[model samples]
Target: MAKIAYILLCHKDPEAVIEQAERLTATGDCMAIHFDGRASASAFRKIRTALTDNPNVTFAKRRVKCGWGEWSLVRATLNTLQAAVEDFPRATHFYMLSGDCMAIKTADYARSFLDQQDKDFIESFDFFDSNWIKTGMKEDRLIYRHFFNERTQKRRFYAAYGAQKRLGLTRKIPADLQVQIGSQWWCLRRRTVEAILDMTRKRRDVMRFFASTWIPDETFFQTLVRHLIREEEIECRTLTFLMFSDYGMPVVFHNDHYDLLLSQDFLFARKISPDAKSLKTRLGRLYAAHDVTFQISNEGRNLFQFLSERGRTGQRFAPRFWETESSLGRERELLIVASKKWHVAKRLLAAIGAQTDIPTIEYLFDEENTPLPDLGGIQRTLEKRTRHRRALMRMLFDYYETDRLVVCMDPAALDLMHDFFSDRSHTRLLRIDCDFSDSYLIGHARRVGLAGERAPQATLEQLLPTIRNDIANEVDQIRGAGFSHHWAVQERASEEENARAISNFLDLSHETALDIVRAPHLFAD
Candidate 1:
């Protein structure tokens, strides 16, 4: 049988992306990588250096200067697929991914999962699905007059956001192809990728219509699949976990999410920070036959911290091609707090990021801990002196510029949340409720590495439900007078769905937020 092919779409954090490629390729799969042209040469160079000795790896020549919500993202993705088509003719399944994604299961397990199926694995939603796209967002993308922004040097950013904020006269939807949208991430047979590429090349009208449309990455492949394959030939899941807040912003992942990552039934989990040292180490150890192994790098950690601080500020920087306004002037601040579970915060924030342009600050308490595998290596310890941890929290809180704050039921910060609520300022609190339900039960089991003889188990699963109840009771009194948005993290799938609602509530550029929520294409992945 032909081995699987892994197509990695990368930007920033070459270390994480390249490492994922190396690990997957080592599993007898071939690799095709595409780097965005706009990325600094050093970024691409880092990937090249990492893969230099690996003969199974290949890079695409048709590199695109990918911009957020731009057609370049589609070009880069298709170009890589096209190259893979020609290069690895026998690749059984072409798995599409970003640099930040990590395999939840072993590569062998994932390959077996793909190899057993002849159908495509993707998450798709009809553009006409009122359930997924509410209000005017859907109508605007399909019916509005849109320009790809750079062609006219206009609202490049919002045009990609895919909501109503104009440039030209409304354009009619193409009669040639059906328009559909979904997560850009997918796992498809080699033949499916090739057929889509072929159709895109031969159908000039199809390409043109999508090229000018916002977030063609989401619509293009989905339409191709619906056009070429039968519904019976499709598997309706992307198997990647990308959490969004109720407001439609991506929940940033952290080390504390390690237990959550392993607990997931998904094969891939998105968006690990390139510099998330602790999380990466844990992932490496988990996948390394459950034996602890780590490549020491402090540079990745420092860079992550610096970038995180920048993200917290009102500093809204877009690609050279995008046109945007900074929300720094708006006092509409958001803080994500979950009382008991780290996954709740991740899910809520992801939902919020998807809907709004307002920058969010995450006051994460690093409880994303599970027992270390029985291997001896440099272990990261999160247990800190309570006083020191509290003091640091105070310092960070004092300096955070705020217009709105969300407390996710963190009792440690209840006093602070209460202070913000009682104040005369306009800060708002968005409370997230993550019930200790069935999802929690399964996750607790996974963190113990149970369900099979991979590791020990049993006790943590029992106490988690109780902890969930205790935290819920403690935060009942901290309601704020400012604007507040409450959301839930029910499980893996539901948590990510909320990013869109959160985005709309935050008043993100509708056109731009639409592209993100539909495609979830932040890093070309």
Candidate 2:
């Protein structure tokens, strides 16, 4: 049987967009189509590169601007379907996705589900059921699906869908049948897709009618499906699973409210930062053999980090074409961050250069720029000491820029990294944890005689036993008035200490002070 065609609609953030495409293609059954509408050539290049080495990826030549309430999306969607139909004629389903949204299922599972005779996956939300009269409709929108082509035929239909409890229209369609305000992103079976496309081709009036509806995306397919069901035309149900919310809001520093939302049973959610740990931890529970993986684009930074980390350093830098406020050129920043440094402050500069340029500033400790101290064995210690601080730096920049960063190295930084970036409404101070990883920055030592080739790993293994002891001794020193600055480790010593640790972490990390907001539970434990 022909497999489901994975149709990814990527607009920006070419790296993460195509990275997700790569992930989805790994399933081996999905074919990916990439379209660039007013996106940078670099963005297009990334999509092109992603699909180049792959056999299943196809690039669409038609470029259309996707505006809210415009016909562009419809045209694009139809064009992609036509291409998929031509390329993979036997394909049975079309899975549409946004560039930023990750794949939540393997192709095998997707094929299995799509192969099922009685299933159609669409997001469902109630509409006009309450306070419908206020909208001024005279008939149910569902009833008008047939006569939707005729303007005069819509009055009674509006009354049915628009009338509230006061209008004697108390009838409740099956929540499934009730106006299923579906997501623009969805998986449509062949029959459903073909029906919609056929109607588009056969009826100009249908298109014109939808062109005038509010939120045309939700109305277009919905009208057809409602009409189909009413006429006993199809077997499909709207899924009421998963609600979405932004997770990298700056206020997240004040409180990790997004973390709470990740704990719920949501089949899918979008716009999560790759580095968000608390949210990752909460959402990781829902991960299965089939689930989409996503990484947010750092407003406009981190592409170099992604390239370098993915070992694409030799790849040519293609500048994306766009109007920018930066006179030096929008592409200059990419070149700046990708260069190697020869000094300590320059090293710091190298890091800053890698950061997205949204109000980003560099803070250095040198006054005269003297030779930096290599404090015997202290450089290694300091790198460990700076983990949380560095994480905070990344979190701050990512939040301010509203872009995602592709971490270059060290999984040691994952959890702390994520916690620092989880979306919040206000910035809050949070303490950095130095003990998240057992390994030290022995890179310099490893290269020199001070540490052996296996020394770093050996030190990591030996350091495990000392972690608690060393941190405890440090805590004791602080508690006894030897030091007053607030400090806390990831591992808490007691109930009070744990709470205090959490409080301190929040206090030092949050850039602002505000009540934490909560999101619906989407990830199941």
Candidate 3:
């Protein structure tokens, strides 16, 4: 007899929201929805009119204009929760969800599952100790006053934040309250919900403190629930299945993810695209189905394992952790070709391809044509490649099927060459120094459509010497680190001398090296 009350906070897609509301209330559970004030009034009215006839549904009287990383989100949730509590007195539990969330399991199953558990399900951890706040002000989130909307008014937000830092202004938390952080989605028992509402009513100072706190929606309920409940009575995890990309954004579900969604034990999956009609329709039918005996499958776990392995290694054939001594002992030798000139590197790689069956890749980190898997957008893809460069390179090494592989390094990759080559005793380094001339810059500019920029010409003139010095410094540091073998071919070396250098570097016969150096189509701009 554990009745559930669903509090939905929606900002867009009225049709989708209506469908979700109908599906949830079809089984007799009560729901309260709060539409953002900033959203189109017509969209909100459309949703309300569709669900008006349903006795189990109610709309919040108060609507707030919610902003990302703002207090209004928490306010919207509170408004909806208050409405649901007032309308549905018999409800024993309250679950908060966003407009994008959809029930993945049968309502009977969710009710039955909750009936067997007395603990509240939420993701809560110490705010300072946890690494959950990726790429942001961590402890500063609580200490500083964030008055501006971080999403819309980024400049003002940072300006205020900077001013506060300069003046050393910080707010102190109440000694009674322990600061905690968690995801905004959570399910709470009736008593817990009542306690939270009661605390909000009585503790005006605590609420005021959180009103200006950054991303308070994630921390508000999380901190309060921990303060109110016994440690043993809480399960520190969300019932909603959520996944984030490397860029710290939620992964949107699509039509093809139906099987993946079904395998998860969580009652709900979120951030589903409104355009995914097929996925939404199938999940709606499943949610409204009579079957209560569905068992969770292992496919979800298996999929996570596959993704985790791919994340640890690359698309290569080599094992995870190719840099480790144990993995290197069992793996093939790796040759890294470094140069300040892209054309020279390409020539060497082409030569290697012609002479030996050794797999060769040119410019592994080339932003235009990277060897890494496409990560949706160029900015996100570039950030992932650069941030996890070493891990990605190891993955690439594991991916190739060969006794020996040669990878020509991009000029942009020179900054990381020293650290990359350090302590990799199994890897070999071949450095080719070529003069960085104005003609090379001009050719590159023409190729990439930057030929008209006189600024680039002057910039290159200034940067040429520095680029050469950096290359020379990295070469010395890498050689000092002592890899399996290190060879350098100076800038003015003749084709024959360069061929001899390659032969020495690869331990190949002079005739074979000559054939590689003299291969057709060796020159490229």
Top candidate when judged by TM-score against the true structure: 3
lDDT of 2 by residue, 1-525 (tens): 436776776666676666565665665655656564745566687678766887667756577655433445666777777677667666677777664343333344445545554445654344554332232233444332222222212233344444544455343333333454556666666777777777778777666655544445665665566655433433333321232212222211102424333333232345454434555444333333545443333222243335333443445343211111102111111111111111222332222222212122222111123222222221234343243343333333333332322212122223332333332322222222332233333433343354577655767565555554654454343345322223432322433443454334233223211111111110111
TM-score of each: 0.53, 0.42, 0.61
The lDDT values for all models are 0.57, 0.42, 0.74
lDDT of 3: 0.74
Question: Which regions in candidate 3 have their CA more than 4 angstroms from the true location?
Answer: 298-302, 305-525
What's the candidate order when arranged by decreasing TM-score? 3, 1, 2
* lDDT of candidate 3 over 1-525, digit per residue (tens): 789899998776688788888889998898899988967688888998899899999989899987667898898898899999999999999999877688888888888989999989988999888887766578888889998865344446889999999999998997899988989889999999999999999999899899999989889999999999999999999999888655344555778778888778799998675457899889889877886565577476466557656765565343333233323222346688877577777777766755554557667666446333233232246565556665455444433323366777754454555545553435677887665565775555556564455555576566556555665676666566655577776667667896788898776878888786676644434
Worst 10 residues of 1 by lDDT: 319-328
> For residues 1-525, could you state the per-residue lDDT of candidate 1 as single tens digits?
547777877755576567777777775678899987856688898899989888778888777776555577788888888777788877888888877677766665565556677789887677775365532246565555445532122234355544544444566777755677788888888778878888887888777777777656777788788888888999877867665432233344667667666656567787665336788777764543533222323243344445445554745342110112111122234444444455445444444444332223344334424222111111124343122333222223222312233333354466555444443333444444444565565565566464443433455556556655555665454433233554332233342454544444443445554444444322120
Model 3 TM-score relative to the real fold: 0.61
